[model samples]
Target: MSWLLDESHLADLSRGATLLGTGGGGDPYIGRLLVAEAIKEHGPITVLDPDEVDDDLFVIPTAMMGAPTVMVEKIPRGTEPVLALRTLEAHLGRTAQATMPIECGGLNSMIPLLVAARAGLPIIDADGMGRAFPELQMETFSVYGVHASPMVVAGDRHETVIVDTGDDDVRMERLSRACAIQFGGAALIAEYAMTGADVKRVAIPRTLSLGIGAGRAIREAREEHRDPFAALAEFFAGTIYQNVRPLFRGKVSDVERRTVGGFTRGGCTVAGFDGGELELRFQNEHLLALRDGEPVCVVPDLICVLDDTSAEPITTESLRYGQRVVVLGISTPPIMRTPEALAVFGPAAFGLEQPFVPVEELVSERFSEPVAV
Candidate 1:
């Protein structure tokens, strides 16, 4: 029932988290680095299986809810989550047994670790989403009817709000975004206070292992001189997509960023691949992937734009002209295929009349045969 993720697993976990981010999860680097540093400093984070959680144990999932672009530049003062969690715990008149990660992609994934490390608590090994999302209400938490409000959203100096008005998740999302915008486009937040038994029932168990496994598959595949793409394809029933189009690789050519109705909206262009090309459009998280006007991938699915050689994630905010990069597409989860789920993230959601092409089918028709890997 006891487990620990070593420092060595960060990269794999990060990669997996990035994949799960499904184009909306912000870049995982900052989160990964923060968690890595904390692990290195305080020793690895102790993990527990969902079953290990007690029915009576109070659990609060922690994460970052703001523009990914602002995270790197602002450099968290590091006290937001620490303060937010403390405020929540204090209000509840009880201590938390373990901290949970609301979303496991990018910075959100790492925030819980930091909170747990700073507050000296055990971190539950599972989370609401296997990846990341743009809104707080879009998660396994919503499906489970776990209310995510009265939650504390904090700023660098510990300025915070304890919100709980029985608002729906989406309303909570809007409120958090407004708070982040007021705080200048980035809000470190935490929520979903539930007992360990509820967490055990609703949270996906050992999902972290999935990230580590997929990441290891990629590394081992490349090391063995096999097709890393194919290896990943097998890991997720996706096929290898070799049509890596040319995208500008350099400092961000130009960035247009703004917060609209609480959503962080903006896109950037890179100018190196061929006299300046390749652009990414994002809303707090990457939303669409285009290479010279051709759709490589889109949201409701996972599209990870990573360094060509190192496999590092380049944040939409941090991306610029002249930076070398390669974009990779992993299929989206089956959940997104359901008519109901698609209603929220399908092409129509982005104003595209295109129908939802399950990543499995997309990979099969666009890449290789549809075999696992």
Candidate 2:
């Protein structure tokens, strides 16, 4: 059923999206503020459940593309996403009936709301990735063979650039990232303009609800004086997210970071109170995780680091030495574990020289057989 989006929903969505971000997607704070401002100016946004969308309605998936750290310095003009959407619609010769997130994490999760509220369109409760990935092509849409061409890129300093990269999603990502650099490290994008039927078939279903539920679960746990991380694990039990488990709890012992080619790349070491240590590597998002030098988790799966006491997520850009943290991992969706999907987002794709192992397989003692959705 379709529902209304209000500030409370945005708050939970921000929190849940941050956790689901898997230590990337940029902070949700700025996006949340933009969304709140848009709502106040234009009134509540109508959020359409994916199933209720008309099959022929044109849905535009949108997000901010570039370095998350850079975005903090260059605030959006608020018109960028709307402009990108309109540009894409013009390029496609059709008007968008709705807006949807490319991923349900951080800025990308809330960006579609800004577009929806400004454009007077309903936002869909779905996304390409149930969680976030650093690369644009690493999504369910591409896994299902959706063409990511004919995208629109817009920013405060550049003319809107329309892209048509044929069947190469990777090339499209390269072109978009370059545009982000030219536009001063971040740009708003509207891409994968598809019919509603296409979205229903390829998008991760009800991810918005999943994020909201996660946020609410965490908040409610805090209110009731319970363990928030425990609440998160329990809540994921009934969601499409599978085999959720806390991987490690430690204090940051080291960080090696740099910004290269408009992306944040680095690794951090967390030393447990028990004297062991875990390592996490990232390129914009947490991609590889190791427990005492053994490969414990890899990409396509999720590796989320959170505040030890508050359960707030720590994105790669914000990770620093001396912060107490909890590391959690969850199995990627079954659809994302196929051979084709793995080829795009597996550990090898990240240039890591290790075999891709499912999080469930890596730590079977921490996971049960996932319930069929």
Candidate 3:
């Protein structure tokens, strides 16, 4: 079913996207403002369920690529995403039937809303990843063999680059990252153009609804003074997530952030009230979470660091010392947990020496429900 997305649901959308962002997808504030303004000008945007898309319809996924920190400093010209999409369409000699987000992360999630509204096309309610990952090649589309090329990277200054890497997803990412840095640290990517059939085959379906529901659950809990974390967990309990539990709750004891290799790389230590500690590693998105030097959670799964009191998500770039937080461990969607998917984005892929372990297994006692093996 298709539905109208107007100002009424924007808050839930923002909150939900942030939750799925898994600690880094840029802040949703900028994107929300952009989207609201666009809707004001363009009327309410229609969101199509992935199932509603016809097999041959063109669907272009859109995202803002590069350092999230830099994006905040150099605000978009508001034309970047539409330019990227139109440029891609001009290259392919076809018009996009709809737009999709590469992932349901914070900023990326809302970027597509503006694009779809401006283009007068519906936005798909699905995404490549159920949560966010740091790299272009980490999306479920890439894992399922969708080429990243025929991609368009549009800069804030109105410059655009069309990439035709001919099957090298990593090289496409490298070139795009370099261009984004050269363009002053931010660029909008409209890529992975594909038919609806491919989307149905590879995409993590219904994530928009997932985000909306999660956000609503959290908001209602807060409004009712119920345990927001428990409400959030309960929401996930009905989803495909294998585990939805807090890994740890603590005050940040230390943080080290650095811009390296065109990526935000850093780690933080959180001191538990009982004197225990948890450490998190990241390259833009939270990748690993450990307790006392032992691996409790690793990438390809989600390790969301959220505000302990309000349950608001805390992205990697925003981590600061002394802030109380609850680290959430959520299993990746079933598509991302498969053997083939694991080979591309599992623990080893991120330089971790250990094998990928399900978050449920890692925190057996936290979840009352039977954890999927």
Count clashing residue pairs per candidate. Answer: 18, 0, 0
lDDT of 1 by residue, 5-88 (tens): 767888787776765564445666777777777777778777878887788988888878776656656677777888888888
Each candidate: RMSD to true structure?
4.8, 3.0, 2.3
Q: Residue 143 in model 2: shift from native, Å?
A: 1.9
lDDT per residue for candidate 3 within 83-143, as digits (tens), equals 9999999999999989999989878888999898888989999998788777887778988
* Candidate number with the higher TM-score (2 or 3): 3
Better of 1 and 2 by lDDT: 2
TM-score attained by model 1: 0.79
In candidate 2, which residue ranges exceed 4 Å CA deviation?
A: 365-373
- When 1 and 3 are scored with TM-score, the better candidate is 3
Point out the worst 10-residue segment of candidate 1 by lDDT: 238-247
- Look at candidate 3 and tell me the lDDT of residue 198: 92
Ranking by lDDT: 2, 3, 1
lDDT of 1 at 198: 82
Q: For model 2, how does the per-residue alpha-carbon lDDT over 153-252 read when each residue is reduced to its tens digit?
A: 8989647999889889999999998988999989999998888898878888888888899889888988899888778878888877857766788899
Please, what is the whole-model Cα lDDT of each candidate in the order they appear?
Answer: 0.67, 0.86, 0.85
**lDDT computed for candidate 2:** 0.86
Candidate 2's displacement at residue 31, Å, is: 0.7
Cα-based TM-score, every candidate:
0.79, 0.96, 0.96
lDDT of 3: 0.85
